[model samples]
Target: MPSKTSIFLTGATGAVLTRLLNHPSSNTFDITVLVRNADKANILRTKFGIKTVVGTHQELDKVESLAEGAHVVINLAEADNVPFMKAILSGLRKRQAKLGDPPLLIHTSGTGLLADDARGEYITDVIYDDLNVEQYKSIPDTAVHRNVDLLVINADIEGYARTYIIPPSTIYGIAKHALVDAGVSNPHSIQIPVIIEASLARKHAGVVGKGKSFWPDVHIDDIADLYVVLYDTIVANPENVGHGWEGLFFGENGEHSWYQISKAIGEAMVTLGICTGPEPTPFTKEETEKYFGSEQWGWYSSILPREPGACLGMEADVHH
Candidate 1:
């Protein structure tokens, strides 16, 4: 019988990772998760039969210790948490040095790194493809989500770990994971949920500027499938696995404009009697920040133009 792969996971409570943990194939792995609260972790532990370590990103030592023993370390936490990443990499490095076998590190990033400050008023033709080496390298360091991704890629290049970066576009749709089977409904994604909240608060659905900005979108289930495929591919042929920045992956099914999104929200609100009309309202940048807060202002307001040619490549590979 084949031995079970030991997988160490962080951000197990998150939407994408939650779906991953509940995947039927995940049962083949001996999984351990690092969660902030033991009580909160119990649900997944019971439903998925995975072990848990109680800790947060702030507890670097504990995180490193947990990561050191795994064949795969999957990080779905904050993309910009450099200190936490460094700690995980350090632990993986120590293990690699001792065993002479590098473990796979699957890290989450987002297409938001390629976002432009359009404030939903305009669209650009500049699109990035992961398969295009020159275009991928052309991404500036100043990009919103670039720093942490660079750190992980550089670590892989330095032989600390075999790292893969999954940069998903805006994710939508309800999640169906082990927790759901155990009677827990996963929270909605940030964009639509915040828009709904703002609409309810202000008595109308609103969009930033002209709301012309566009972003790629994918279903939560599709995103989960990508994770499973990538994990299996890496474990099966670590020798042929892509290295460093070359391991970047993206997931996008289709693209939508913010105007269309807001219009749908407005129409829904009107149908539900939450609003008087279906006409979408426009909010200035200041108004957007006021409603969604400064931290998420860009997420709801900025234009993130991404091409899914690379994602399509992966989809074809997985399906065929």
Candidate 2:
């Protein structure tokens, strides 16, 4: 049977969750979002027309009652939201003992779970593929994620819910409600100011230090599509994996040098009408470092290598 209103999305109103809720397909499913307040959740329900369950994560034993007979539970639950999730999973299992079937639980995890740089490289396709998600769950650098991901993965074996983990890279998307200050500006939103200034001045946006420390990034639209892909897989088979997604993961300039990055930024500013004609002036490595406030600042210049021209158009086998 179609999950319909039986779907429960923890962190229903989270940033990524917020974007998912706004999609046109949201109405096609009878989604039940779990939040902490009836009033605020009610606003979401009124605005988005999804049911809301009010309770804290630690109070998730109460969630199963709210989720009775649910088919799928997509958790965008917070990183620290595990206490609530544990309670919910345990509670759901107990409820299922008397009720029959448990719901499918789609869990979220950080891709940073793969913390070991096998090649001492920031990130790369070979490095990414060499790391197993299951193995990644055990890496020491990702101790917290290991425990959380393990809990979700073992949910069914422990006799609660069927589970799936979505380990995401640096997620960049439009914000829903300025939930929290995200420290650094989203790279996609505004052109890097240094790049803009240098590009306009027609100079290189040089790397600040030894450019290293690769960061994985995906557009908000592509990230959202990853979920859509998951839903499609679920339609064909419930036991689908997200990291298995195939194709280009990064867009144009996924991997760029300080000079190259600056050039691209200058190019973008022109496209955005932020800068006219000339490329920006170059900054000395030290100057760049000073502007960025650390030798680490130069790391942004070193992007992971691009797969191929056409390949850049594809996304990673994120569903694996």
Candidate 3:
């Protein structure tokens, strides 16, 4: 029998990765996940029947060793961790040297790299095109995730690895997977929940500034299927899909302004008796930091890409 393609995956406990593992195409590939907690690793091993490596992404040597054994490396962990990416690229380079074939690296980035400093005051007219190689190259290295994106692109340019980046914006919906059922995976996404919790706590939907900042959105399953489609495309024929600069696939179906979402949340809160007001309220900078965490308030207050290219033809089945 022919051997299954080996895939080394990080962020096994995350929502997107968990849903990707649950996809039916996952059975065709040999997937080994890197997990930090020993008990979660055990559950993923015995329950899901996939290989497990007990280590964090911070462990450079361990990460390098694992990447050396895989035909593909999917990094769903920290997007901007330079050292972690460097270690993976180093291992993939060694593997390329030994096997005389370049391996594939699929990195998860965010559309926040396309963000502008609107600060929730107004929306920008610029739309990011994934197919525009020159436009993508023009993104400043100082942007949130561009440094790591550049690292992957440079590796692809050096001919050691074929690299693709999926930059998803505001992923929603609960993840359905065996790991989630086995009490191992985190089934929920991040941004919307922060809005909800903060709203419930303060008894009004929280908005940052004028809340005019908008971002694209995608369902959990729809985005997961994009990953599957990319994997299948790569396995079928590497030439069929673009790598490096041309390989950025933005995962988004629709767009929503922060004000629109917050108003809906406020209405829902009033209906559910969680809050008395049906109108959204603005959050102070300090309150935003306190409720949404110091790091995440910027996203709520800033404009992400108004239009992200859906290069692939996958239609999102779920809606807001």
Candidate 4:
């Protein structure tokens, strides 16, 4: 019989990771998750039968210790937490030096890194495919998600863990996880929920500018399946591992316009008697901040477009 893979997972409560935890293959591993809340920890332990370590991402020492023993470290938490990432990498590097083999580090990112920042009025024709090495290389260092992803890839090249970045597009749909039996489901996707909340509060639905900007989209289940596929491929064939698969792996199945999404939300609200009209309106920067708060204004209201060519194309094996 094959030895069980030891998996250290963060963000077990997130949308993608929640589905991953419920995947059939998840039972094949010895899983330990780091969660910040006591209630969530109890739920994960009771519902999924996974071990838990109580700590936040800011707790570097705890994160490092948990990562050191695992053969695979899957991080689905905040991509912008550079210090936490450094801690995880530091632990993996130490383990590599001692064991003479690197662990697999799967980090979550998003296709927003490819966003053109059109802020809703403009559209770009450039799309980046994961197989297109040149386009991947051309991603600007200043891109929203570039720094941490580059950090992980560079660590892989330095003989730490064999790292792969999964940059999924805006994820939708409810996650199908065992935690749902415990009456817990991962929250709805970020963009749409905020729009819904603001619409209910203000008595209308709104978008940014002309709302023509596009973002790639994928279902929560599909994103979880891709993670499992990548994991199985790597574990089954160690010889397939190298720097070649170190960078971005996108999870987009399709794309949608902000205007169309807003219109749908408006129609839903009207049908439900939450608002008076099915016609959507546009919100200015100040108005957006007033409704969604200043921090979330840009994220919920901007026009972020990914070029059509940037589709992931869903390869079963990462090497291909």
Candidate 5:
């Protein structure tokens, strides 16, 4: 019998990673995860029966060691870390030299790279197409996650690894998996939880400015499935999929304005007796900074106009 494909995974406790582990296809691969917490690593080991390496992304040598041993590397750790990316690529480069063949890398990026500075005041009409290689290559270097993204692209260009990038939009919905059900993994996502927490804090749902700026969104399940689909394709025919700039794939179902999201949150808050009414108010700058933090202000204020182009060929199961 053929041996199981060895895979190295990061961000294993995340919603997407948890869901990916729950997929049936995952059982066919020899999966290993790098976890910072030794206790969480033990839980993942006991629950999923996969190899667990207890180390943080900051440990470049350990990261390189793991990458060198794996047939494929799926990174969801941090999208903006250049040093971490360099470490992973270094290991993969060594693996290619030893095996005389390129390994596969599935990287997780974000739609924020395409976000426009509308500041929740206006909607920008510039939509980025993920399948258009030239368009993706044209994105300015100053974008949020562009530096690390360029590194991955350059690695692919150098022919050491077959790279595929999935840039997801605002992901929503609770994730269901053993780790999540066991309370070891977070079921909620980044953006939605911030909004929910702010609503609870102020006793009312609110939005940044006029909340006219919009962003594309996807259900957690849908985005996770996309990862699995890409993996399966790599397992079957890695050469068929696009790589480098051509590999940019946007994971989004539909777009939603911040006002609409706040309105929904308001209605939910009203039903739960957390707020007085089901109408959202615009938050002031002070409230925005206090509730969501100054760093995350762009998330609530910018317009991320992106549409899935390459992965659209497979037809994403939209749960929006």
Candidate 6:
């Protein structure tokens, strides 16, 4: 029999979090949305008949208190840098110290921690079932991945919490109604950066380098599903699944080369009346800069091969 678990999600209304809420797994587990607005949280209760707890991003302790003896705490809140995540881990520690059993913690993170994509190191295809945890932790010390992973392990040592990380390659899924500042419109979201790369491909973008570095990616829904799957997988098979661990599911449906991306952008530019179709690839990063803007193209994100599966087979009712 599976244990009835309650999960507290920090970024409850995010593109990925939205998919998790509507997933079938949500039916089995008791979910509590942790957001900054009490009114907004209450809306989820009225709409989905689900419970939402209003809480701040930096202070997860109050949310922890609301969680009380929850089965899981899923955090996707990373404000500023790594401090927010470090704070969540700290909150769990306080919970176990004060309360009896701190919940199992699930963190939404990226694989860049394993290798610095900016440094041109990309490692893919190997499964966590085969690799050693401590070894991958050594890849990029600068990668907040190492710090976050350590926090989970530390919590486990104190018997405060069991931590799991669901690392997304590059996610491009249906952006939620409220998920603004993402996708092709903003170009900062993982979806546009990894899968679409519209700003970079249009010759409107520049490479953070020679424009050849690449990274793996997945669709946001598949990424969201993994969290739900992780919770259920553990609930049904604690005998088999380890609590203190990580799952690296790149969820790449298709691998596209950098050249292909540049070509696609060229075609789009001509179609959108931004540039002539025959215009040479990146004739000048400045020319294309009009569209993506210099600030948006600060990091040359256009060149990487999109990790496959931006759109899983399922119909995306959630708008892009």
- What digit string (tens of lDDT, one per residue) describes model 5 on residues 1-320? 13777889888776656656666766667888999999888888897787999999899999999999888899976788889999999999999999978888999887777766565677765667776677788889997678888999999999999898998877878887767877668787667666778778889987766677777788988888888888878777867888888887788888777778888999999999887898888776677667655524534332222222111001112221
Clashes (candidate 6): 10
TM-score-sorted candidate list, best first? 3, 5, 4, 1, 6, 2
TM-score of each: 0.87, 0.59, 0.89, 0.87, 0.88, 0.69
Candidate 5 error regions (>4 Å): 14-28, 295-320
Worst 10 residues of 1 by lDDT: 311-320
lDDT of 1: 0.70
Which has the higher TM-score value, candidate number 2 or candidate number 6? 6
| Model 4 TM-score relative to the real fold | 0.87
For model 3, name the residue pairs that clash. none
Candidate with best lDDT = 3
Runs with alpha carbons beyond 4 Å of true place in candidate 2: 2-5, 14-28, 36-39, 67-69, 117-126, 130-138, 141-144, 175-209, 239-320
Candidate 2 at residue 47, lDDT?
Answer: 61
lDDT of candidate 2 over 1-320, digit per residue (tens): 54344677766654445555555666656777777777677666676566777777666557756555466767665543557667657656765776676566666665444433321123345344423544443356434355666666566666556666665554444543432222211224222344345334534333322223343455555655665566557656755433322111222113332334445665776677766632434345565455544433323321111111111111222222
How far residue 153's Cα lies from its native spot in candidate 3, in Å, is: 0.3
Clashes of 5: 0
Model 6 lDDT, full chain set:
0.50
Error of 6 at 49 (Å): 2.1
Q: List, in order, the clash count of every candidate structure.
A: 0, 32, 0, 4, 0, 10
**Residue 228 displacement in candidate 5 (angstroms):** 0.7
Q: Write the per-residue lDDT of candidate 3 for residues 28-99, one digit (tens) a residue.
A: 678888988899889878877879989888899999999999889988776778999999999999999999
For lDDT, candidate 2 versus 5, the one ahead is 5
Local distance difference test, per candidate? 0.70, 0.48, 0.76, 0.71, 0.75, 0.50
Residue by residue across 1-320, what tens digits does model 6's lDDT show?
Answer: 23656666776666555555566766677777776766666667776666776667656456546545456787765422356666666666676677666567876555444333332113234333213655544455454355665666667766777776655555654554433332211213443454235444443522233333354555565666666677678767765666554333333343433444445655666687766552323324463354334422333333111222221101111101
> Which has the higher TM-score value, candidate number 2 or candidate number 4?
4
User: Which digits, one per residue and each the tens of the lDDT, describe model 4 over residues 1-320?
Assistant: 23777889887765545655655776777889898888878887886787988888889998988888888999877676789888999889888887887888988876767766566776666757787777777878987667787888888878777888888776778765556546545545555666667767778988777777777778877887887778777877866743434456788787777777788999999999888888878775676667655524344332222211121111111222
